[model samples]
Target: MALFKTSNPALGTKTFQDAAARYGGAIDVANRMTLNGTVNRTGILLICAFATAAYTWRAFMQTHDPADVSGLLMLGVFGGFITAMVTIFKQSWAPITAPIYALLEGLFLGGISALLELRYPGIAIQAVGLTFGTLLTMLVLYSSGLIKVTNKLRIGIIAATGGIALFYLMEIILGFFHINFVSINGSGVIGIAFSLFVCAIAALNLVLDFDFIEQGVNAGAPKFMEWYGAFGIMVTLVWLYLEILRLLSKMRSRN
Candidate 1:
């Protein structure tokens, strides 16, 4: 099996390779991954995420106080992070861990979105609309072969994603010292442009993710990999939505 680098860590070439090797030479028919199965599983995970998000959204709507939901926000952020790490390393556990991760992220997104919505108004819905619209457009393009996932394309996207990740890691480390990357986070022209670039990159990552999942299915990966693949797609969707929300917020802040 040939492996390719992808911006999304969950659907990397090594993931399929490792899964194939672990399952031995003969692929199990009853346990083989299918595209339809992955789609259904992804739907389930999205529902799980939205359910928790609605829960948090309702709570925040009632109190309208950031302080009231601070604890829930923290739990969602840290808990989601921990669960994501576990699922990444233990891919086989995705069936169990993916929903947990989704549920936790919903809490975080809902709380933060509620807070931000109070400031900007209507931004959250706009972000969600754009995110899903972008996803649909990209899916159509990929399906139509208008956007080919070539080796060069994958390599470029993967490299750019790594650089962005490093930049964010540095930003987080610098924050402890009260330093900030205003150039990238502010509402100035440069900041807006930066967010646009990041959002575009994130949207492109979905294409790579789609390719990765298709390849995994063709590779006859284990049935459990359907859940793992869905988890990977959800990760990208979450990142894409957050970036869209951030971009919208920055644009709104300037107004």
Candidate 2:
């Protein structure tokens, strides 16, 4: 049985296990995954994301019109989704698809952040700081063994994440019918509380990602798996950043 599991769909329990089973005997030590390699790949992905994000940010700032970048935003949404699906099914293609995924997400995030920053001045920087702070804090806690990824903790996080995903899906469906979840989406007490809970869960997911990546490194997976591992961490970081942005926006709206 796999000894590690994560709430992150990109880093499922079977991911490393299956990779190890299939590639362990074939790949030599030089071509096997390593912790440092994964970290370096993750940094490269972050740079890729930031690069495109800066472009979209500047474009939006020049026009100051959401309509101007709406097309790019949509492209990022659908393109990133398709690329993520491809990477998940074809893990070997991660070395290529992962950077593409980051770039697309950057487009989406940059447009959204710029739009929000117009409403709440300095909100974008605030969100970025909080996101990285939370990431660093979680890393320290996980590294210090203060936040153990026990079976119970993993299961609980997985269940909570699934529930949140379902809720978001339902919200999207409701939008088709012109239904609005006022209390949950508005800048109210309930909405703020819900955002806080989500932020907490998203941060906890970083711990799970950390644990999952460590397992991948230990399993002697192929070198390409390093890209896949970085992709998984990127997924979690994106989620955490978006959640933190939403929470910050909600709080600012109340002010």
Candidate 3:
């Protein structure tokens, strides 16, 4: 199979190629990867994420203190990053690390969502609805052949994602100098437009992820690839949710 590009670090150009090499070309009948298995694994990861997320959310709701949830937020942020790196380098360990990633990310999401909800009230639920709504819409389009993942489209999405990531990185780096991309991150029209654009890019990355995961299934990758595929999908979902949350925050701040 030819290489393809995606903004998702988990579903990079050679993700399946590397996975294929992990096990020999011969397929294992007992443990061959299937689309259904991948979907099931994804559901499990999502459940794990939401379970931890709910715990953090309840804690914040009860305490009503950002300080109380700061530790969970930090743990989720840093811990998820480390776990993602580990899973990427060692795909076979995805079964172990992917769920951990989901749990840590859930903690992060819960804490951040609690903060946003504290100010914006119903924003977290709105973001969650939009995020999942986008996911289902994309899945239908992908399955119905409405949103074809052409090489050119994939390249465009990957470029846009990389640009967004670089933009965020620059802002983070400049934050230490008491400088940031205020215009883009602010609640102004331009900021809102930027967030909308970013949210769209993040959502479209789902199409890319779906296509890539299906390709893996067709290639008869190993059973463990199910976990890797699920992990990749989860990463995109997390990104989409965060972007939606940011966009909603910007919109709400305007009013």
Among all candidates shown, the one with the greatest TM-score: 2
Q: In candidate 2, which residue pairs clash? A: none
Candidate 2 local lDDT, 132-238, one digit each (tens):
89989999999999999999999999888888988999999999999989999989999999999999999999998899889888988899999999998898888
Which of the two, 1 or 3, has more TM-score? 3
TM-score of each: 0.95, 0.97, 0.96
Model 3 Cα lDDT, one tens digit per residue, 1-255: 112356888877677766776673776766778899999999999999999999999999998988888999999999999999899888889999999999999999998998899999999999999999999999999999999988899889888888888888888999999997888989998999999999899889899888888888776778998999999999999989998999999989989
Each candidate: what lDDT?
0.88, 0.90, 0.89
Top-lDDT structure, candidate number: 2
Model 1 CA lDDT for position 103: 93
Tens digit of per-residue lDDT, candidate 1, span 1-255: 012356887788678667867873566677888899999999998899899888888899898978888888999999998998888889889999999999999999889888889999999899889989999999999999999999898888888888888899999999999999888899999999999999999989999988888888777888888899999999899999999999999999998
Model 3, 32: alpha-carbon shift in Å? 1.2
Top-down lDDT ranking: 2, 3, 1
Name the runs in model 3 displaced over 4 angstroms: 1-5, 24-26
